[model samples]
Target: MNCRGRVSPGTAAPTEERSCSWLNPWVFFVSALVIKTAFVTVCLVVFLHGSDGQYKTLLQNATEWRCIPSMSAGKKESWTCCPKGWKRFQKSCYYLPADKMSWAESEQNCTGMGSHLAVITSEAEQEFLYNLAKGAATNAYETKYYIGLSASGNGQWQWVDQTPYEKAATFWKPGEPNLLFAEKCAAIHIKGKTDSNTYSNWNNILCFTSCYRICEQAVKVV
Candidate 1:
């Protein structure tokens, strides 16, 4: 007897579709992308002071949640603790080089922070600062810049605090700081023995002057 017409028992049509048959990998991938986009959008909106995410509450008082950058609190791009308007010089911060200013005005610029215009105590320190003053080379018009030191208060050669001019005693032109009645302001002068030291006159001095200013209390780590 031939069995050609009889169908096999084991092989048959597939059962009804799975309950989650539509959840293919590609479908899941598109769904995941959409969810991620929505989450990010919600975060940005909250950050920009949109719906306060507390949709359940009726009152909509704004809330602030700031996120700081990854840098340490005290440290910034190049210098540490640098505030606006100050440029970093060596380890300390300095004001931008400005034209001649009266001693009182200069004092005000530095007073709030307990820092003052630069002052040099030693010959070596002087050279070091002069070189610093020549920074970047373009806008450097003067080899000498004003510092915080002054004998302004007592009419005696001294640092800002009335300390005697001690350090490596500053060198001066023979007749410098003639202390002319009107010549209270100090300016550097060429110290060639032949040249007269006139307080009213200015020069590209080849020698340092005793009447110069020096800054106290530098703000830098050793």
Candidate 2:
């Protein structure tokens, strides 16, 4: 049949069918392009407005599944997080439970929670913990929290996590770690009152002495 005429008996098919067939590819192409554009637009809107901007920024800058806050000066992102009721600082999460226990018991408790007793390694960390303990203090003299430090039989101090002990980096109170007594474990004694020498609050006490504890764990990337 001709391009515009209907087919008669025993005639070939009309050109309209060929024309319709030729248009199918362009129609499909346009439909697919519209669907893809709509999908991208929806995704952009959700990303820009439906989610937290701060979290998005942190995720974008994260490396190897680690979030490092730019404001922390190369430190791990504090806001990236810790478990509920725990505090975040640098790359670690700290939990200060209210119940008191012996140094060994405290260490075991921390281990059960997939952590160790706090292994404080810097002045900033010391200060952070000191302040945290101070706020939880009900009594100035009794507000002691067990840390990860312990003394070996040979008088060598060691961290529960096996961090090397450095005398210069220690924050012991003046005249502390008295070898005269059998004090073998270290704790932070919060005086409750502000002092110029705040960071030097650590004291070596009897390992079996009951005190609160600080648990430390690395932050998990969500």
lDDT of each: 0.44, 0.81
State how far residue 151 of model 2 sits from its true place (Å). Answer: 0.5
Per residue, candidate 1 scores C-alpha lDDT tens digits across 26-74 of 6889999999999999987776565343332212333222212234469
Please, what are the lDDT tens digits per residue for candidate 2 over residues 58-167? 34533333343334577654446556677888779888999999999999999987789999899999999888877777755457899999988888899987899999
TM-score of each model, paired residue for residue: 0.40, 0.63
Candidate 2 TM-score to native? 0.63
The root-mean-square deviation over C-alpha atoms between each candidate and the true structure, in angstroms, is 16.8, 9.3
- Candidate 1 deviant stretches above 4 angstroms: 1-96, 135-144, 152-154, 187-217, 220-222
For model 2, the stretches where C-alpha displacement exceeds 4 angstroms are 1-79, 193-197
- Relative to the unseen true structure, what is the C-alpha lDDT of residue 64 in candidate 2, on a scale of 0 to 100? 33
Model 1 TM-score relative to the real fold: 0.40
The alpha-carbon lDDT assigned to residue 218 of candidate 2 equals 84
